[model samples]
Target: MNRKCDKKCLELSFPAVEAEASKGIATLSARLTQNGLPEHKTDDVKIALAEAINNVVEHAYSGIASANVQVNCRLCKERLEIVISDSGAPLPGLRIPDGKPAQLGSSIQNLPEGGFGWFLIHQLTSEIRYERYDGNNHLCLRFDL
Candidate 1:
């Protein structure tokens, strides 16, 4: 990959609601595809981006209305960096695990309802980071080309 050219970045902001969040992911995926990201890697990027945006819609803006989520995508030589930010409440006791798939039980009854998103995000990206500042939550995900 060529890392020599000037870095390029894109920024998008939308309502911190489920509907708009989906649009945000779509827009990001389209932009990435236009920038020469491979189809398989673009699929991974879309999944990770959706997971991150959904987290904000589901967790951050619980009971709140009219809030917004901000997303910034930076294209570097070796990887693409995405930063998702929301003005809602921060998650308590948040942790970014090693990029490993969650162990699942054999039966469907043993499945969990809410823990898969983080695992999927970690698995799809090479790096993950989360922080809370000024009453906002910021999640960063990096995908290697």
Candidate 2:
């Protein structure tokens, strides 16, 4: 069960690129850890946030040289909510997979080459939501703390 208390929110804006994404994840992970979040839970948040930011950098702003990605994190006593937004091309028809873990095959040859990011995001987070508003793509992820 989750309960909400007074919220402490942090907002970060950075370049929508692979390097910035890594830095954002590191900053977020550190903040969460400093606030007394468990190590495993913090790691889960970091991984999910990395995937979200990377999706924006790779797919949303592929041709663009530079753009901005905004991350807003709201922390409460029992839950943490993160919203990542970017002013890039919105997904035509973004369809997240059903919340199921990706199946691993028996051999290395059967390994997936790509398309595992969303699966991991969904698996790690308690809730995942996406929207496009006012020319910006917003992806929201929630975790029960």
Candidate 3:
């Protein structure tokens, strides 16, 4: 990843594998604070951003050779816009998931394993959008700053 740092924008690209994704997210969260994203909003942004990227790594790239995850964050006085792109399978039906909270089962062992990510993402971000063009999936998450 070629790293760039400033108060308004941070751009990075890395292989979209599990370990790399985690490291990428951590790097993003840490640098965001230095790039003028309000401290209070960094956690929310990090959580939502991680969920989105995890989905890409776990679902989009499943059964396929991993590719690059492109991240671009632009900070404005009113909002922060993060654009994450990958050349993986398009979202099911090419739209954002409904993201309803996952249903819980009674037993501890029955607890769902993987349904809460989108719900948490929706709760954290002000707006979310997705698109696929020219074989790349673009997910834009907006957080009011």
Highest lDDT scorer: 3
lDDT of 3 by residue, 1-145 (tens): 1123234577889898989999999998888887678888988999998999999999999999999999998877778889999999999999999899989989999999989999998999889899899999999998888
TM-score of each: 0.84, 0.85, 0.93
Compose the digit string of candidate 1's lDDT tens values, residues 57-97: 88778877648889988887678888898888777775554
**Hey, what RMSD does candidate 2 come out at?**
2.9
Weakest ten-residue segment in model 3 by summed lDDT: 1-10
Span of 10 residues, lowest total lDDT, candidate 1: 94-103
Tens-digit lDDT track of model 2 for 1-145:
1235576677899998788888988998888778667666887998888888888889889886668999988888778888898989877676555645457778999876767888899888999888888888888899988
TM-score of 1: 0.84
Ranking by lDDT: 3, 2, 1
Q: Clashing residue pairs, candidate 2?
A: none
Clashes of each: 0, 0, 0
Greater lDDT among 1 and 2 belongs to: 2
Cα-based lDDT at residue 93, candidate 3? 97
